[model samples]
Target chain A: MTSKSTSPRRRQQPPIALVILAVAGIAVFIVPLIGLLARTPWRDLPALLTSDVVVDALRISFIASIGATAISAVLGVPLAWLLARVEFPGRSIVRGLVVLPLVLPPVVGGAALLFALGRRGIIGGPLHQMTGLVLPFSIWGVVIAATFVAMPFLVITVEGALRNLDPRFEGAAATLGAGRWTVLRRVTLPMIGPSLAAGLALAWARALGEFGATITFAGNLQGRTQTLPLAVFVALETDRGAAVALSLIMVVISLTVLIVLRERWWRPL
Target chain B: MNPLAGLDAHLVVSRGDEFTLDIRLRVPRGKTVALLGPNGAGKSTVVAALAGLLPLEQGHIALDGRTLDDPDDGVLVPAEERGVGVVFQDYVLFPHLTVVDNVAFGLRSRNVKRGPSTAEAKRWLERFGIADLAGRKPGDLSGGQAQRVALARALITDPDLLLLDEPLAALDATTRVDLRRTLTDHLAQFSGPRMVITHDPTEAFLLADEIHVIENGAITQVGTPDDIRLRPRTPYIADLAGSNLFIGTAHEGTVTVGDHQISVADRHIDGPVLAAVNPRAIVISLAEPGGSSRNSWNTRVERIEHYGDRVRLQTGAPLPLTAEITPAALDDLRIAEGSPVWVSIKATEISVERD
Candidate 1:
């Protein structure tokens, strides 16, 4: 009865907005969402969704982003562990380098990926000469570009989680006759499981939205290398209505993934 | 069977220029040895060195006729392979694992597969009376429950040596006393040589068959609990062993200090010396002690602290002296600080040694 009586008063709360502008300081973010929703074309949405180019780009985008996120967890986690745990000369420089891609413009990262993995590039030349293989303008190039740009998010997140964990747990595992690998697998990873999940989600989201690097490296090929963002970019140049429909689909998929993630893995539905 | 036969270690670990631990310690098989020291006296360093967690610049460690660490000879086993179990100051239970899984961890690491190792973990959890909490994580356990889980975790492997680093320091006073006896009984039944480091004398005396008083990274004194109580070498050890320590002089059978010539027993020096006598040895009376008493002094009472069955009376006289007496004695004499009292000790009770 007391709670019921308090509900109306809660609904009639005062306008304390400008009185406290600190919380409302980030209101600029909502303008984009408002603009996106308003400009998204509702008519001809079904025809746009049924387009063969749209379907193939969507499939490639999902596959490449998920693969990049998987690769990030495998390689980035151990590197994060090393950055967090071990001490050596140039450690600070190595840690700084891990976050380089976070600040590097996506197009610059694409150029960097091309120089390193292009057909005549350092390790790329030997691979091309020996196996007649190259990563440039291919589905694999999209993965490389996404991984390059998205790995910093996974590494930094997992590293922060590792730093916050009480190191005594690892010591306890050591005294229990477990070696370093066993301790990492059984104790350290499980202890940071929440952070791992959160980091993977963030990295996957970042990869899914990758455009500059994927287009520069993979050349927006339909059904082969083009991702959803690339498809949306091409549609924006040619057909504005179709561009809005593709963008709405991207928004829906991202929103659904985020909502499901929050409900299932994060907040425990 | 003796799990460890006479573990001997001479460990030297230096952190900074000022912090150094160079001490040798020994624990016989199936005996509980207490490493008694004050805070920051390198007791934990000794434990860490023995557990092989810290590297020693100069040391030789042998357990049960096996060479575990000897830096001079280049033989050092890391902590995991040394087969030494440790209960750290904070218990160090894995917060992500269940109580049972934490206990079963050691067995599983030794390649004893899941079902049997978990059965062993269950038995240990039952032994510590925490079987119902087996499925719960370490974060869900209370202090006492976590301590028991840590104990079960440390003991499941049945390591060669069991080292406890201030196991009860984290608990409340009441929990400490209760757990002290429980831990003591469990340790008494432990087959391996056990070592515990603590600053509490009562804890040391209760759990230790023999006690070693450590000061400034060296073993200052080593003896049974009674021996330490009777003759403590340093001020901290003296206070811990319930003895009043003072600096005085002895010539023949008389000690002179501050214009007071007190008669004592078996004196060889006429200059400065360390004089220690048990607080329980001094008797307090309402008047001057009668004739034939070797030493008697009129002193003003300073302070008093109740220690379980005994009352520790601090007094200022010819020397700062602490006396131990029964509560009954306290009531009979009406002992209070600022009250003039007569303190007398037999010549034989006072033990004097050159510092």
Candidate 2:
């Protein structure tokens, strides 16, 4: 009995069941934020933020996360371009391996890293003998763990953008006397600027919030390996007020970064 | 020097069983050749091969005495080093860059300084009468404007060879007319040999000094536009050139078509011959009152189409023929679809060619 005009009305307002599901979805995400805000020690926030343990963890977190993001940007973008543009034997397999960290548990990723680069590990053993470097239980180890868990975000984002790019532009550039390097540097990268920004932001945020890999591989050290997430975990056992304060700080920082990135980069073309 | 010393190519591109393009063409410097073919007849493949975008399965391509591709010698220059420019059918301007930058891309890639390249690009834009749109993105331009931008981008490289793939196919009728004029001017200014790929015969005849007719991945004929119009070898070319073609075996001056024999006053061809009849030369009548035209047939109107002031009638066969008549004649005879009619044409009107 439905008419065409009424069908438009039906489309304008989704089914009641779907509306209820949407409300439930929002509640699932927003309720946690509300809980964190309510638990925040607002009266003691300033004091808790300035405490020695919080300051040390925050400094460590900043250094490790930014380091991890820098490494990922330098290496991951090229890997993304390769995965998207090249056709070689075992290409699909290489692509799968690049995205494995996104699905693997962070603790397992840390364990795999440990086996490969630990003091007594396969490649790490020769490295320690030659250069006297031991990575596990150190600040560098923390950055490595963060990169293992977060680099995949940047790679996947940039790779998807690269794959969807209209290759005709490259063809046109080639015919216009551009060498392969020039086209990649000037034309291809500049065109995908927004997606690159988006990928960098996602990777940076993931690095900042990394918890399991940092704890498993780097181990908790008060002024070195313990990032904000690890500090929150240890603080929750003895100082609930400090833990809530640190979590609030982390939430606010990430929210501000994401909003800034969206405004600057992801505007509709 | 030989006249065919500009852009010469003989190539075979195989796309499995779906299609294959086997073509041989040449265009001397300051000349334009049109590769005219129907859709899916592999005109684009020829353009791609010439530009070094697609590798040839066999044969070689050379431009201005330099070998661009030769499978036997392993002297295949990459597309970026081929010194060839192309304006794709869709005018594939970069969606991200400004109009001026898109045009200056070629110069910039060759390490020319920014100031000179931008100035040169701007001048080209002014010539295209689109200097006002220099800062605008391609998404903001109309179809005709985009076409001009594509042309400017290609020509800025000063390439030794240029290829245009259906440059006018993406525009509306009025815009196509305007852009076609602009393209003619630019082609005159470019010194290199240029090849234009198009399916429109009017576009080909208007712009090209020579036409290469391709059908089913092979070049059936290569001649001037008038030559192609006067004698179209294939039925597809005949339709495109607006002539009705009848292919049959000939004995002396008589050609056997289907179940009927028509006498043609042409050179005596012993075996198979192609007979081309101008559609306008054939007259239609309600009654059989033809005096001297022994070349007459009884036919029924299959369809009638209006083309400006003329009505073209497609008729049923002993030998199916398309004939054009004045609209007034159409009304006087009262011919509609399925109306039985007599078609008459003099023997001298039919041009015969050895097949």
Candidate 3:
């Protein structure tokens, strides 16, 4: 049986031309990472990384990205559940609006946020008058901008997982005397834990790498809104070594997160 | 009947473009009723309706005289508050929780603290003979082990009514036989009105005091195991139990079923009676043979079914009945469906019982 199976498997190999094309596809993703590694200033890395600009940018990026992930978990999970489980009018329209950011340009999303929440804009003007506060070019602005662009990853992922779950588990839980809140907290949440974790990681990664939205909606200031991406953008012209160091830091963080979450994200693929 | 006795339910629910389920059931305290039916016969619908998962369009359900559902009066109790414990098909154990935690879930859901709930769950697991599997997740347990955990979880809540849906359908043949004995013992300990839903006649007969045979969203017959086996009312039940039943008037030594008469050894039975003839008791031949048997008929074969070493044929003619023969005998007779054959049954093989 083993010999007969092996013979057919060997005969089913792909053509050499397709194999060559597949190798070229793989090279397209790897060549750029090799280029970045070749240009690194190995000896001056510590000094370049510890500079005041890089340190401040690191702090702001951490705050904004982590804050965005927390807010997304709070708001996105319920939204995903409602979309997957409930039926109401205009639900498709609401879902399409929620997913609009994933396909919309980041600059356009930032501009839309400015129109809705900027100091001189509609809700922002009345709020500013009441609280005597400003929002644009602040640390809060960076978090809001990151959340706007990053939350759809969490929503769509969680919604898909919710859609695929067998509802019989929830029904069984109910028959076991579990109320609605207890059932959701104990059964529904844990069953989707892997997908939730994967969504959070993807959202955090996207938030950490945010550049266009932050620059458009939140101005680039050293300790306020200048995330790693913006700091790298600013240093690319005058300080190439510092830019390389900042890029390397982001690469390391994103790579570590992806590796830690590889099992959850890779299984479905 | 006492008003505050046990479960008394009349369920009428309609699904769009599909069949409407309309069944009336009553189980006194400390009795088991089996809803036996084939697939698509709405056995699950009965479970869902009684458990408060599906509301009835008409009729009312009362457990110990407390109304659970009445569409006319607009009283519908949710599933969690109904106190109906259902062991769903395939168990549906929580995959993320350990065996102990899954069993403890009922108590925890009722606001019992974790420490006490865990202690109680461990005791239940010990009673089920699975205390060693407490820490293992559902994915690590076998089918029988999962079934025990599911039972433990349902019984922990002290429900007013217990429902087991196809409990033994998921187990292997050997495990099913072993677990069935365990299940019988456990079910005897629960002091409540219980219902077992299954398609297997043997399981129904073994586990239930009374059986309700459902077909196409309706109950066709409700009786004891002996009643269903000896006097099947419908062709489906007769075929299921594999008993060729004849209901007719009995004379001194013979019973006239339809246009034909069957001879039995009993000479005193008279009036209406039910006669059962086992398919294996009938002998089939291609040609007429002289024999000591008192009954013989020339019939055509309507259907032929092979069951491993033996073959069962449905005979069509003046006396339509089922006859079983060995495969070698069937080959020697050179018969197929629609072939003419001779069937004979000894007078001593017929069992006569009151209708």
Candidate 4:
């Protein structure tokens, strides 16, 4: 019989078992990161880093990711607000569909993007016929592809934040002589600023690392369409060291920005 | 400017098989009324309807002589155009904006540019004694500070009707009591109609000139605080009535119950009447012979609950009664559950009314 007076002894795991479990998780993630750092050619690193192709890929990645982020904010934030606040028919279905990209493979998402925005696509055909512009293998196409894949990240983040916010704040804004558009611009947007930043960061990361959709739709060119991820993928076929080095740069940039973001804004209330 | 200065609402709301707010009330300019109710008494519904957040099922809402909502006339003012300020239950402060920015939000919406809006916000913050904390976000402030900011933001636009929905329920007891006076001062300074919803009688009494008690979705009584606290009709009302009331048959000068003839303070044509007595009014003694109090009975103590300064004795005789006594009296008499004691009350202490 167990009594309240006597202290309970903790069950211990075997040293071997603990070591094995830790090794499994580490080998999948930490080991690969260590491999990248170790395999980096310190002698050829400077020459490879100074290359114009690498510089252009980095520039394209930054510009496209930022463009995707801004576009997502303009479109996705409102969509998120609508999803959270509006009470219309098929709302539950719309919410489920908004999070659909998160569970899907990026490559399959690229293929679906191709079918929709291809020359003969429903709306794409009209645009191509009227304006003599086919978006395939273009920088703008890369942005569209990255946006389609990354926007859901922003939408989901903002939607969750909006759902948690009390609806009364909107009412308070309305009573203060604010119209619908004004409440969205002044009150609702500022209130969810942190969630918006978090959403932007995630979307930027997703857009920057986009290899499948960009290559599939925009067809990884030398400088125009080739982002850092596409450059790394192309380099993998020729020089493995160069591929690792490109990935390391992307990793360093993302990790540094993420650290800064967390320090400035994600503190516990 | 919004023309909702004096809101007169003939409100009708029904949900499911029960609950309705089919009552009419008018809030005059420059006065405060409290909506007091239990948990699900549709108190918030009234505020929501007035604010135009919830579409009313029926009735007419006219503010400042302009119709806001009239289902019969197809008149409904949009929530954005209603111009009825609200301080929500959770404070609902914009988590991202600083105190100044959150306050400025209202003025900014009124087409006053940023420079003027923030100046007005700063002025309001100074009035609330929170100008020093104006740069800080809502997440940085304490509960009391946040609530003041919410009130300030709601009032900054000088709205016609201000609705506060359980604004102090989120506060600690000490802070709640202290904030009541500050809120009262603010309400007095404002010249618009105000409605405050609260479940606490103490809060309602402190803030409201007129009190409306809602029970099971209907306005059961609307009166002064004294009236609601003393002359409660329903059980929910009696719960707030402070004094304990019991219904019993009156025979001659005595009332028969559980094999005992109990004397009543009430006289003249009496079949049944509710005996009202304050728990503090009854005196408990150890002696069985009782006293010259005119109404005394041999009672068996059922239970004893110790309050901070006093003890409530729930005793059983012909009728079960609860009496509040000081701890010293309880200690001296050694009062405990199942003890045989004599309970006495002055005839003047008891008041009887028809049930």
Candidate 5:
């Protein structure tokens, strides 16, 4: 039945080298996961994950990642709409700056954020003096750093969706006496729901896996600012078993998110 | 001057360096005016301008004694405040909403309570005879059903002006006839100014009270159906009106069109039908010629018009039709206005289709 369903031309065997390389590509991702599984201490996994350092890291990771995702959504959606719809001078420059964090090294982004918002830095000096507050080496710094590195994912996804949407749907709504806000809330946003979901998932995953920016900007304080990746980094130097356990947790989370969102990310909306 | 009662607008908009639309339109209360033009003839531009989706670069638009857009005076009412209900091409219904929610959207946007809006929307669905489809999404509807939903959504807002852009251009031929009748009934019920934008000459002639012939961003002629049909000002309108359309009841192989009866080639069609006869298919002779043709009549020439290499004779009497003949044939027959002529058409030449 399979042979009858597929055309004869499509049933032809692919080239040998192409097949070999495709298998190699699959193996490249699978090999490291297999290695991690081989090294996992399954019986001691629950005890290691429940330790104080691990528990604190888990709480901090959840707070920082979810908080960053919320912030990104609030600020990035409107920024994306502006870039997609409005025509302004230097608009391309603003778009390039939004996308810079994606391709730039995370460490570089952390440094840039530090220079802008550090205690003694340009705006940070006045901010600290006026409010008697500091941002670096705190949980707030972790969220900021994560957002700086992860928000581009959401902005780019939503911008592309907005650009591809038919403007006539919004026009129809407006002609129906819907105000601008109502049209955006009712028509434009719902029509781009799939892409927005995909963008949020991608951004959350990126924030969960963040290491360099968090460690560089927020510092590695075990109970205050240390997150999962920072905990892994600290454990790698002192205890290899805890490091492996943390890595396994991250692997499980990332895999589950990807499996759930595979269709949205890989296919055209 | 007395305040205008309905829509009164002069639209002038320039897009870049290549195209500029400049036209004036006046649709009185309780009248349907059609802006008829072919593709790229600025039909969409007119729709957009009237719906307040695009601002006029120059000129004023006044509806029911109120000014909507006047560029020189810096008065521009945004689309949301224009009180215009538009059924866009292809309907453009929100895919995420159910039929009830889609209908209720206009009321919801006006700050109406959810319970009242839903009840009102359901009543409208019942009025349109689609109450059972209230729970279904737009993607699940047929083309005709979707058009009804679009109409309901637009009309629920109770706007002062209703605009339909190619309302039936998306449906199949069989569905179009039924939907056109439904649309005609709906248009009659709306007592506000209504405008229909279409490229189909038959739709414009049948649906609108006044026809505005637009070409190259300008209106060339404005008149009633018969005036536009018989005294076309441009070659484009001449070409469009050249085909004669007759709606009649068919029995066996014969169709009764108004006062005259004509034989059609399709013997199996036995209901109301639309028959089309091209001007070229009609043969004109000075005397009654005997041939295999089944339909021939003695008629007087009411008008004679020449359109580039061809002469069209507007015949009067028992059957009125325009027949195209070469300039040489006109010289040979020496036929002029008020001349008696014999018109004959083979039954096979008349194309008949279900109305």
Candidate 6:
């Protein structure tokens, strides 16, 4: 057994400081979750979760998050490809701007979205005058807010993956009589399938957890803009049990997705 | 053979540094040209330029009288439309796709239906004897299997020009030998203009009908492998051709090389000349032998390389020489590194050409 210990696969002890900090990190991450689980009204869990307000919020959150993920996939994938492969003037600036929403406070992003698409706002003013359409305080607006904050997760993840992929594959495809579109659809996308899945999962989770932007831009209209996090926030003041149940639901969903994705795709090969 | 003629290109590619490739090449129908050069000698650049991956800074590429690239004429065919199939240095088989799917990609891109495309891809796999592994991804295939698949994929396109970039460089030595024969056979069957980029002279000789020696971004010489090997134009090619070359002034039959005067058989060029002597031509002796061999120099052995069956000795200057002798000769002469020895060469054995 000791002789087998000489093999390279034998695990080495981590540094004491790293071990301490890692344990501390895990404790901080899980402690709130433990508290939420402990405080959950198990007997009343089914009834509380099935309440009209909670169910409606959950439904809205699902629709909005799924919509956001769809939008991100449609727009963010091409943007990621562009950032990873193309070289142009202002490319670095464009890349920095893509990640701005990720670092920018959600409230600020909401405010920016408002200024751009709000009534009597910059683009919104013209849009209203031309089409008489108002985007704010709508389900579409909630999706837009979640997308603004969440698409960056997908974009950055996919971009990093695209950057790491060998561009030679694309070259090989092209030389094999594959057009740009064919190569993108057939070669480039398929090669980065895992990263795409991971990015979608991450973006979906972020959209599901979105609060400040949704509340600010889409307003707190129940069943319309009030998603899971918004519902949790509102319930915390009046119904702690409902809030805990809602929070637990959100946690379970996002954690389940991330865990399954980690096991299937995200783990280092 | 196909109706498509061949490739004719005069390419000028200037990249970041002052490294510019200004070379002209031609690959006739039913012939393969091996672009031989060391790394950074623009071998891959030439392949890319021909395949339309890299745009020409100046000049034009024409295949079968059709202009592929002409910067002056504002004509540049994109890589996809160029009809040039490439087997990249790494073979670059799409890792995500099954073996058959990877082969069918080119056909599918050309708008062939899935049924016919899969059937055609299967045909190629059968040719490569990997039809059983059609469902397997490229990652699961061994290097040799992957190379054959790459060739099959490229050939299925029925391209006007086929480019193989160091096709066998990634395989292990034994696999390389086996695949080299397979590649040579495939090249014979594919009656299109082909170009193979390789740094190994032996690979160039074995796989290609013609050899183009490229060095420092320019084609130094182009000829049959024997022509290039026997009369190598550059020091790099000389080394790659496995010969020791000396550049000096030749007067009458005597050539002065770095203060050492050696006699050559031909009084061909009087001025600056290149003299190439194969390592097998030079003979080493424990003492200077008085004979008709006109060239003799006393030098110390600098290094001894065990080259499988034979030992190659690197003797010290005033005329630094590399000589291959039998191990029995080495043992009989009691030669080791740093041993003083006399090397002799017949004047007729050295080939002289104008520098």
Per-model interface RMSD values are: 1.0, 1.0, 0.7, 1.6, 0.6, 0.7
Report, for every candidate in turn, its global Cα lDDT versus the true structure. 0.82, 0.87, 0.89, 0.81, 0.90, 0.88
| DockQ versus reference, model 5 | 0.88
Order the candidates by DockQ, highest first: 5, 6, 3, 4, 1, 2
Of the pair 2 and 3, which is ahead by TM-score?
3
RMSD each, Å:
11.4, 10.8, 9.2, 11.1, 1.9, 10.8
Native contacts, share recovered per candidate? 0.73, 0.84, 0.80, 0.90, 0.90, 0.92
- What interface Cα RMSD is found for model 6? 0.7
- For candidate 4, the docking band is medium
Give the top-scoring candidate (DockQ).
5
lDDT of model number 4: 0.81
List of clashing residue pairs for candidate 3 = none
Residue range B1-355, candidate 4, lDDT tens digits: 3445587888898877766778778788887888898988888788889888887889888878888888888888887787788898878887778889888878888789899999989999999999999999999998899989989998898888888888789898668857877888887867888888999876787688888888887788989876665455455665565565555677666655446555666567377655668888888899854446777878799877665676777778566776778899999999688999988878668766543
* Tens-digit lDDT string for candidate 6 (B1-355): 4344798899999878879999998888889899999999998888889888889999999998799999999999999999998988989999889999999989999999999999999999998788998999999999999998898999998999889999889998768856776788887868888999999876788778899999989999999976676555565765687777676899999999989999999876698776878888999999887979888888999878675577777778888777878899899999789999999999999988665
Q: Give the per-residue lDDT of model 2 (tens digit) for B213-325.
A: 99989999889987676555666766698877666889988998887899999746777776878888988888995588988878899878776677777777777777878
Instruction: Give me the candidate number with maximum TM-score.
Output: 5
The residue pairs found clashing in candidate 4 are none
Q: Which stretches of candidate 5 lie over 4 Å from their true place?
A: A1-10, A263-269, B1-3
CAPRI docking class of candidate 2 = medium
Clashing pairs in 1: none
lDDT of 2 by residue, A101-168 (tens): 88899999888888888988898889899999988889999999999988988898889889888887
> Chain B, TM-score, each prediction?
0.70, 0.71, 0.72, 0.69, 0.97, 0.71
Across A1-269, the per-residue lDDT of candidate 6 in tens digits comes to 44555557866678999999999999998999889999999999999989988999998999999999999999999999889888989999999999998889999888888999999789988998999888889898899999999999999989999998898888889888888889889988888888898899889989988988888888998888899999998999989999999998988887888778888778732
How much is the lDDT of residue A93 in candidate 5?
100
- 2 or 4: which has the higher lDDT? 2
